[model samples]
Target: MRNIRIGDYLVEKQLITQEQLENALAVQRESKGTKKFGEVIVELGYLSEVKFAQALAGKLHVPYVDLSNFDIDGEAVRKVPETLAKKYTIIAINIKGKRLTVATDDPYNFNILEDVKVMTGMDTDPVFATRTAINKAIGKFYSMQNVDSVLEGVQAFSDMNNAEDDEESKDRVESAPIVKLATTIVENSYRADATDIHIEPFKTYTRIRIRVNGDLVELMNVANVVHNALTTRLKLISGMNIAEKRVPQDGRFTQVVDGTTLDVRVSS
Candidate 1:
């Protein structure tokens, strides 16, 4: 069978008009290789991301994965390193015998399949998923590792500086572990496509949760000592008044993740 082009397939299926395809093509050209044709169409509002991905999967004769409801296999996720998965925007979702099934937004990129196969020593099965879904899965799965060590580091840092004055504590908030904790929380939240990140203080510990797909999922809880430093780091980056904690404050910051700029709004 001859490989079907996404644009031609969409037009043949009446999903998009020829005029819209041409317009998207013009936009893609204007991007000067920065964007793919599918990306241009989605960005141009001609097709929803999921719709485009499904159409592309049908055209490519590959299975389409709805990652939002999919139960990811932890063993499969471990087959692909986080760095490799993030680099290629692909995630291993299942493993059967010598075959590894991975989901990617760009099923047309056979190079990703080959790279994964070589890295994992398995026959690769490529499936289609929306970029957002794959990104969210990557964050949700990969970020779950090493949590205990991270919290331990935070506790150690906080313990060592417990005797410091307020000014000194403020300076220590920029410590390596604290910085990593704050950065990880924000970056993970962004990659997970979370609408809100909740950091709540309780009597004993601080709870961290993120709202994804309209549901709140708890990420982790840390010592109350670590909470002050973590929130301080976040406030510093978001330009909030760290000293004035009694009043509600709002701030916004921009983060660039995997070449995409994300505007993050913070409330405290």
Candidate 2:
């Protein structure tokens, strides 16, 4: 027996009308195999993203995961580095013996599954998730690892401040750990396609939030001690006046990540 196509399955399940599926198929063909049928369906407003993902899970006979409320294991996340996870749009959800289970937006991508298996040295099991959920989870979990490093850098910076004069301390503010933390924030924001990044300072800690899909999500928080250094580093790069605290400032800078230049607008 021949396997039923996704569009036919969707029509059979009453998720999308036959006319909508025909239109989606036409658009998909026009893309020269560049776009997936489900993507075309969602883009054309034939179905919601979540519903398409659920239907895809059923069609593929794979479990569908709602990452928004799911509790993720940190160890599984660690097994797959942030860079690799982002590259493939896959997140490690569980690991048992030599098998690694991951949540992915595209379960049919056998190449990615094979690459992950080779990289992790385990058999790969993929579950279905919406692309939006996978991206949010990556931003939420991977960025947490960087938060710990940023805190440690804050303590080391404090120690250096005690031993150095004002002039020398100004130079040390560009220390390695803090610099990486600052750059990582920008990179993550760019990767998430965020429209804005908010760094809010409070009495005891500083909050970092990014605007994704028109929603402001808190990325992470760090100690108040690192706030000054972090702001200074960002200001220097953006050409803002680091010495002037009372006045509002606006500036723009270009960052190169993965050979792609991104224009960053800063307002303080």
Candidate 3:
């Protein structure tokens, strides 16, 4: 598949109103493909960026950005079997004598080769192309591994990260002030006695809408690009290949809140 922005893809496909297309396209051109379409639209004069981001975020099946300031690993990288890593893209910057290197589907990210070299204190190289191209290259590098299966496992973990099958709501909705996404959804569900929370994906973002009492209500919004990053991070955390996205995947987990153990299920 092409490493393309879906707003561009949707516009080319003629799948939306020109006004909508122009709004999205304007956002894309302004960002020059760096800032996400969701963010750009908000900056430009289009729909209320918040609502649009929320709807788009839900459609994209990703989480919203929160106000909390927690430590996040900035330089996060995974060590896959070089065999598996090389299966998807070509190692454009293969410094024969260095320990750390940068790999990206877009060779353009490699435009700053000198910067990377100076910052990391290691030789810097770049990989350019699509996930499919990288997968093919890695397959040639290591002929025995099943890249497809590895990808499936990764998607499975994405499901687990986003899933929610927690406790049953008892109908007495507690009116303690609103909290985070998880808390709001869980609390609303418990009070309304809902079964599942459905998250979906869109072109340039993901929406965090909730389903309670059999009705759907938009909750929070997040950029599609952010969601994409999160899904990749989740895959890496669950020991799955981050470069593969050809198939649907599922994963699940559990959390204890208020002395109650609840199951969370995620899928993509």
Q: Is candidate 2 or candidate 3 better by TM-score?
A: 2
Which residue pairs in model 1 clash with each other? none
Residue-level lDDT tens digits of model 1 in 90-188: 999998899999999877687998889889999988899998888878877887675666778887886786532344365578898898788778777
Tell how far residue 57 is off in model 1, in angstroms.
1.1
Choose the strongest candidate by TM-score. Answer: 1
Select the stronger candidate by lDDT from 2 and 3: 2
Q: How do the candidates rank by TM-score, highest first?
A: 1, 2, 3
Model 1, which residues run further than 4 Å from truth? 163-168, 189-198, 202-204, 209-217, 245-268
- lDDT (0-100) at residue 72 of candidate 1? 86
Model 3 clash count equals 38
C-alpha lDDT of candidate 1 relative to the true structure: 0.84
The sequence of per-residue lDDT tens digits that candidate 3 reaches over residues 1-268 is 4555646554455544567867777768766779766555555655454455434443444433211121212231222345334433433323346544444443344435555555456665443333433443333333323333433443443344432322212220111211123343444443333566665668755676666667887654454433554444444434454555777776665644323466666666
The candidate with the higher TM-score, 1 or 3, is: 1
Indicate the TM-score of model 1.
0.83
Q: How accurate locally, in lDDT, is each candidate?
A: 0.84, 0.82, 0.44
**Candidate 1 residue-wise lDDT at 214:** 100
RMSD of 1: 3.0
